[model samples]
Target: MLSRARLIQRLVIFAIFSFLLFVGSQRIPLRSNTVPSAPSAPSPARDSSYERQVQFWKNLHNLLESNSPATDPPERLKKAENVLFDPNANYTRPDLFAISEGDVKQLQQVHQRVVQKIKNDNSSLELVYHRGKRGIVSAAGRKYLPTLVISLRLLRRSGTRFPVEVFIASQEQYDEVVCEQILPTMNAVCIVLSGILGTNVVSRLEPFQLKSFAMLFSSFEQLLWLDASCFPIHDAIEIFQSKPFTHVGLVTWPDFWSSDPSRFFNTIASKPEPPVSERASTDGGQLLISKKTHAKTLLLASYYNYYGETHFYLLLSQSDVGGSDKETYLAAASVLDEPFYAVNEPIRSIGHRNANGHLDSSATVQYSPTEDYKLTNQGINHVKDANAGPIPHAFFLRTSYSKMSPVNLFDPSRNGSEEVSPIRGPDGKPSRAWTAEKETIDSLGGPDVEREYWSHVRWTVCTLEGLQFKDWKDKEGTCQQAKEYFDAVFAPKDRR
Candidate 1:
């Protein structure tokens, strides 16, 4: 009954309204749930690899679950745990470190299963390793990310072309932006442990165990495992072709502290005690290992680490300093009678002298594994006499104090009027972070090395402020201070 013009107007308005609604819905942004898959995870090949990884974890988990003391410690072993073997006092238990015969038998069974599993997976390494066969691996959780970034940036700065894989142990440890976006720019990718192991397996994993597992899970046949704070002073890629890796397939650096593990660990491993000369403990900061050659060694190391909390860690370290996972690798190789090169060069410390005449150490400088290996084979002894060995080629500078993070480096108390470290002496000049002596500086890489190091640290602080960590509390102030310090110490004009 309405007029034709009015009816036409109503239809037009309804049609326009429907069109607007449809277009608006189309333009609406996607929630994270609907967002595209992570950049590193889109490939069908990647999906297939993940599935295989899940199966591998499951298979390994079942084997360990049945045998692990965490689930079922033998009755005698439980009783042995109650009986403390005091190293300081004479104790009658021949099985020292409180390890029982039952413990040994169980460990052996687990070892056999673990060995078989490694053999089974050796062929499938091709599938799991979506990245190249020779890549660097590091474990980085949230706490370690900033230090890791500093290391990674320095790694690339060192002119190394090898790709890297950063392993995060759980979903909790993963940072989506950093992993998916930032790392890829550095030719690195993040591998999530929980994604591969599932909740059941990941639940029981310890922080210390992640390093060995990272090496095992990494696609690379040849790997350099570096700690989050460890930085290479030279090109790391060259080590792969060098004799240290090519000859022995496994190489470890020395630590300041001697390993002095209980004699009972030898009995447990069914191997004789190592010679006094070889008792130097592993640094555990940097390692070069070939999975193709040391697959069993890696697996055994993982086993020792997995049970580290309850047994092997104490047995290996006897509660010694520098004790976490430090001894597992060499011990594993020894137990299997696998050939490996242990660096003979004594680790040296780099630091500034404090007001109290004490050295405020910052890092431990470990010599090049390749150079050390060459010297050792030539019948040179560095540990006994510094002059007897090859001229030390400083390889890794592992920061122990004063990490390269902005929060720590630019801390007001450490660098301001109330400065406490690298103190100003009577001359009223502050000592350099690494060293003050010209000869030591030249030996520890070169005159330009500290410049390179500080430049990297400056870049990390200025660029990564948006990361907004609690440690980097005053991002603006930290960045400003970092730039000023770099300008004063390492800027082009300050170059010596």
Candidate 2:
């Protein structure tokens, strides 16, 4: 026990120590600055593959930088430089860049912390959270929405006695799914990969604006690849057994014919088509690959791309060669000579770049002049198990389209499925049947559906959509969690 004045001094010192301890408990990870890599970092700018994002970022850098920001010009340029100029910049051909509002700061900090933490200790804890501006933890801010409809549809379509996995890749379309709704789905694993990265202090949060297809390869390699655009009309495993087109398939979209394919494409292009690999151009949106083969090539390419090495270790097909993972994919395809199926014409769905093009909505509805899409006796009705024999039932393939019009504010247009091939139903009969898809307005409560979807998806699009995040590997982070979440709520805790 000291005297009064000395006691007061000690009290002040103790208060300072307590304050420092509080600050220590609230320590923010360097990776939370909204850049590439690191948990809880505000997502990324491209849900597209890594190679796609590389070029996307470069072109974006030119376009966005030239156009300049409405707010800050020089500072933005400096920030852009911070994004564009990597001392270890992989000046590899065609790799582009896409920087959203928050990526610059976040990735920078994350990089620093990872290095610092490594230096400070032999072992360290993961730093995946951010002290969000609004005082909400990263996990708490999310008020999950419902993925019931999609989950049920996919389950019915997949024909699984049990739940199945489905990855969700949207252009920031639905936030609740990313933030809330999708979190609860069981059996369906929504790989929330986006291609953009950004920070929004406004929401007292940082949001990612995905811009590329980079992470698609990541998920595909990890066996989390499922085309989100595909509606579950039938068995999903049937589709899976057929050789999965890991990248873009040979299928063509109405938006590609005679148009500059470069617009939305970071697609691999080998003119006259690589001989032996019977294929045409395709969209990365609905592609697939074998976990055993194609995914290996994709992973090899992704690793090289991430390392900034010019030549990738993997080999793809001849015609499927070019862009980021282009050469590697083409070489791989060539080696495999695996025939792939495309969801071409006749059956109709929205998502074509310009729906009214040569393969316009009307034309897709009426007929399919292109060979990529033809009526076939081939279709999938149910997911087959290892022991199940192939059934006579069939289905058709269709191109998915999105209606990007100003009139559809915070809304996406209704997608129609094409009547591709007329397949045989059970009992040795041909079936060209297709379910009537609900009108766009009725799909999920109207135009605001897009908004509702985006509310959760936008930020996720930037970070989770295409990044192939490690946490996403967990069950809770999957589309299947939807069911689990529901079960926990309605079912007994012990059962869950």
Candidate 3:
């Protein structure tokens, strides 16, 4: 009924409307039965490196576990012993066990005498220092001798009635200079284990093992095992009389700085659970063992050493210092579950060295005339802090100090002064001088009445012994200074 043009116009409008409707439908999203995708997970923050490290440690731990001596104790022990003591081995010493029947009879006589002495003095204490064949031949032996001399001299100076025994791996480790010249001079007994324990037993044990187990061979009731590096500054007999040593029959100072039992636990391959209440980790440098009372403890410590020897590589892997002896003792104490007294009081008896091997300054404390007496009760006077306090009764000069001559430490003429001013006085008066003369009799006297107290003695010993080493020398010309200082301080007035 419509005109043809109009009908065509209507068709065009209809087609346009249809196209608009289809676009609207496409834009409107339709609801579906399917769930919507989770908001794309924030690309998991990458931790590939951490994950890799975790995996690596896991693998390493597994490898160590597989090789543990627990798998086959007997075979491992035999193998380790053979490797350690084979006479054909370059490291083996045949002299360790070489002794004649006459020598045996003589050793027996000596043992009987020692036993008789022990019987007469049940409360007698003996100071023990052990040196292995290798240690004696190396620069370590040279360095240690001076410390031994210093320790024995200090003991004698302290008027300690107890005798000292210097135990050597063999007659070869015993230098005539030490046995004849040094020990006789100090009145110390030199016992060669080659005759006592025989080579088979002695050769398989490491120097540290010999040190820890020295109590087993001691005829005395109590043994104070001091590392060759340890120098007693105070009356060590005081330690024996202390409540911890007297009550527990075992006493050791904690690590100089750290108290984290977990850190100690990590150092042993066995990873024994730490003591529930044991906060401070023990130091082996100074240990007092009562042989009769803590017989079980000594046996336990020896057992740990045996296990450590069997798994030496694994234990070594866990060490930061390449020494596992301390960790082994710690592990033994943990497994024993018996409480041992730890001198948590700040004894400052241990001297720590910097990476450069010099004494750490911050670790040293300044002496206050009034405060020092109080501090001394806490064992603060044990180290001679430069410009701080007088020399302590005992100090642990890190083995690194052995690498350099002590004479290189300071210039006596340039650094020394006659009257050392106290950093602080009772009333905080600047005029008061810190008189070393007051403590000189207690301390090893030095060049001046001031800074040259025990440090001069330490330098003198080190310089004298260091003269033997090829690398360590008095390059600083401090040896002449030491001699002058010694003349002024220690030499008899007539001799000077």
Candidate 4:
């Protein structure tokens, strides 16, 4: 997690970079000499005419699909030019990213290796990248990777599953992120959704458009959206529950949007009066979205988050933009009244509707009864480290729970073990661990060194003095205890 002040500063910087890129993309000449590098067995991204034009001319280009092997391909712009120019576009809105020094190199090397793997391969299932997504987000010079790309990269690198049919407003940024890091991790590819940011009202958005775009991609009803940040924490399946989308579900909480109105988009949203119904809570971060089945609600939610700029500013003014994706999503839900079923206890559903046309939110549209879910629940810990998404199912959906799996770390005792042991390798001297362990005190969300103790301690134990992992098997060291340790190390003078 990042502090408000530091996140604000970095976002300001990245926003500048994105703005420059956006401007450059629209204004620069698409020189024919500029070619997007294509690797063998490519995913057809760079090979597409739209990509060709984008690479050569930093100008706005449309992606055109071809039916014939030979002859002139028809030029079709997937995203509208006017949409990009709309100051009201949702891309500028708030969302979410950084860290330390010696830890920077390890992250970079991991990132570079991923990038190289993608660049060298031409599989239709290659990973995606964005050109602008370079440099370490955790530490200076260390590149922070797009969670989606990194997630996919980890999946493919481990040979989990593939033929990822994702939706891209345009594959430009996708290719860019992939090219930078997390290339070899792509398996197969299929993108069948919008490629650009929707016509979201801009004034009310979070001011960080790229995050909006990324989240929109997450909402594309494609990726399983495994929770991760910069590094691949462990081995897990990308679990492309790609079966068709059956219905949309929301975690019903009692009075979440107590005082707000604004259903979703400002163009057409009412502020929350006093809330309604018995249930109204939603994870709003992790989601299992799909366009094929009955998930129009998800689409509707996307529109709210990516609508014309009018609603963007409206939403931002009322909300903190701190929860980043989660915050925006909840605000939209409060305003949109999109149909979502409540999942109180866990594992309550499993399949698609048999003779259903579309889903009726009133009746329980379930794959199975909620009583059957038996996945181990590391509830407190997992929920704490849970990735931001619409629903929280993926936390331990199919995977076994380990204490360290963010969601499972709530109990200090079950801090779970590291997947890869940080052993003193062949070179003797405790092998240097690749990590993001150190950062300037200013950046770690701390005014004083001790305030950032948790991050520091975790950083120290995970990587410093040779990478030591939290061993759940041993069932030792509680988080509270760790805090005590942190206080001792950083601020011993004022202990109570």
The number of the candidate with the highest lDDT is 1
Model 4: runs farther than 4 Å from truth? 1-142, 146-160, 163-181, 188-221, 226-245, 249-285, 293-303, 307-338, 342-496
For model 2, residues 198-249, the per-residue Cα lDDT tens digits are: 2221122112112112332233322222223222334444443342233333
* lDDT of predicted model 2: 0.29
Candidate 1 whole-model C-alpha lDDT, 0 to 1: 0.68
lDDT of 4 by residue, 1-496 (tens): 9999999999999999999999887894543322133321233344444344224212111111111112121122232111111211233322111112332343334323332332343433121333222111110001112223433443443344433433333333233323322233354332312222222322234423223334333213343333233221222232232111233433221112212222222222323333222222333323443323222333233343443232333333233223223334444444445443333322211111112322111001111112212211223221223342223232221111121232133332233332221211223222222211222112222234223323433433332112222123243444444445445444555663
lDDT of 4: 0.30
Taking all chains together, each candidate's TM-score versus the true structure is 0.79, 0.32, 0.48, 0.34
Candidate 1, residue 357: lDDT: 61
Off by over 4 Å in 2: 1-178, 189-224, 241-278, 301-332, 335-401, 404-496
TM-score winner: 1
lDDT of each: 0.68, 0.29, 0.41, 0.30
**CA deviation > 4 Å runs, candidate 1:** 1-47, 70-96, 99-127, 130-132, 401-404, 413-431, 436-438, 467-476, 492-496
2 or 3, greater by TM-score = 3
